[model samples]
Target: MNGMHRLLWAFLVAAGLAGGLAGCASTSSTPSVGVGPDGKVQNPVQLLGQLPLPPGAAIRAEQSLIIGAGDNWVGRVVLDVGRDFDAAYRFFLETYPAQGWTVVSAVRGKNSFMVMTRQERTATFEMVDGGMLAGSVVSMTMAPRNAAVMVPKKP
Candidate 1:
């Protein structure tokens, strides 16, 4: 694999995504996914429920929110990983798919980005070199897949 690809996987490692790197071998694997026992996945931006982040992931509490929407819940958490860009990038690339998410688009380099979807959930990830601290900043935004679908055109 190329350097970019390796880093994405490293992100998985340093990000503390459960699956091992070997499990990421088949990027083509398509596993079934659905809402958790709570009726829905609390984390829309991540591949699975609130992922177990690396040792130093500090969640920006004031910026996060979980609100009730009818019988469902909507929320987002802004977390920063205390690692270099490569390590965190690799974490998501490998972890998301292993958890049953389909990667829609992925770009790994100085400025990295990943967009993935699973069932009615969609997550957009961005890794930047600088943020609140000296390490890399991982901004993950998640929402319902239907939230961004195009409106049907009139016949």
Candidate 2:
């Protein structure tokens, strides 16, 4: 009788452990970003709008740019949206430049956004701190949109 009781107790403990681990694994898995009929990863902004955010969670966009000195030179821009440092960092790395502007480097902290660019000149636009608390920050810097070239005009 004593042996049978011990065996039953051990089995129950094992089953409980397994179930707990499985529950955690499923919860931590990344949410799938389904591909559209066009076979491209769906835009995260649109996706976020559709789903409910985690409790106390908020979303916002941060834009940063660095332009190298010179005409028709390299430029960098980053757009990030997330509270998780790792997720925000990954988002900038995976998204930027591909949209148009070049990307130099991006580093995200629990409450801050950091980036470096070196296309023609280097410039940066980041939140004073990681924008994770409550407020939001957006920044941008670039060459004049209508500046004329310094080259001599042909007769």
Candidate 3:
């Protein structure tokens, strides 16, 4: 090929590579479909809402998790509800027992905490007086009662 044709070919090759790289520089956090049809972040912690939370409680979409596997499951769910400290605390106090949990400990006041255990599982929740805006926040964590701190590594 002639020198001019070679120069033009090089320019075209460089432009193609630059365009490909520019396409890679996406500004979106997600590759596609960040929001569902409902306009909320998809793949949310659905486990939170599915748990036996009281009516009107709103689970914090992010500050929740599910851990462990099968019969050894542990999890946490944080909720905000337009309810006073006493009522919310009382709900947990009463709810756990009806579900067959034995109340390990219970306290009542502005910021109260309760611990309940059933079989090999333990559940604990702390009720704060107020949230950043609404009424109160209940943070609850559930785990196996006698979970080992650490286990030996498998071969």
Candidate 4:
């Protein structure tokens, strides 16, 4: 009976060691991007960086709008580009803040980014595409408790 007890103890120790080694070996090397409650990426640009973009396309213009109550802000960014929507979107998301902007939420398929704000207001900007294509438009909208308000400028 003593010999059987010793064998079970050895087996438990070996299993524990194997599990620890496996856990260490499975550690992820890729940096973590923002993820939603469901474990899917919450930022589209981050996900775009992981995918391939279209060819010979450039971003032409980008705009952002911020609106909300005090301490509660919603931001929206629109991208105007020539062709490579994916790359342009990623670039705007990764670079715009360097020019003084904050990104709140980013959705890739829709081609837009939401900015968080402390005040209630809307801001917009433009970027020149310079590519052969005439123009492409991308819009982003964010609402903390209600739908975002977007108003088109009169031509």
Root-mean-square deviation of candidate 2? 26.1
For each candidate in turn, the TM-score is 0.55, 0.27, 0.59, 0.28
Instruction: Encode model 1's per-residue lDDT on 1-155: one tens digit a residue.
Output: 76543544344334333233434664755334344453433334343245545445655545554332221324454666765667677778888788888999999776688999878877788777664357776767655666433333558
**Ten consecutive residues with minimal summed lDDT in candidate 4?**
51-60
Candidate 2 per-residue lDDT over residues 1-155, each given as its tens digit: 46543443354345446655765777555345454463333443333222222223332222222222223312232332334444534444555444444565554544444443434433343533345663333232333333333443458
Model 2 error, position 19 (Å): 64
User: What's the true lDDT of residue 69 in model 4?
Assistant: 15
Where model 4 places Cα greater than 4 Å from the true spot, the runs are 1-80, 110-113, 116-135, 139-155
Worst 10 residues of 2 by lDDT: 61-70
Shift of residue 149 alpha carbon in model 1, Å: 5.9
C-alpha-based local distance difference test score of model 2:
0.38
Provide the clashing-pair count of each candidate structure. 10, 9, 0, 6
Candidate of highest lDDT: 3
Candidate 2, residue 32: the lDDT equals 53
Report the error of model 2 at residue 70, Å.
22
lDDT tens digits by residue: candidate 4, 35-105: 44643333444323322222333222223432321223234434444555555666656565654556655
Model 2: pairs clashing at backbone N, Cα or C within 3 Å: 66-123, 67-121, 68-120, 68-121, 69-120, 69-121, 74-119, 111-130, 112-130
Per-residue error (Å), model 1, residue 60: 0.9
CA lDDT of every candidate: 0.59, 0.38, 0.62, 0.41
The list of candidate 2 runs beyond 4 A from truth reads 1-86, 110-123, 128-132, 144-155
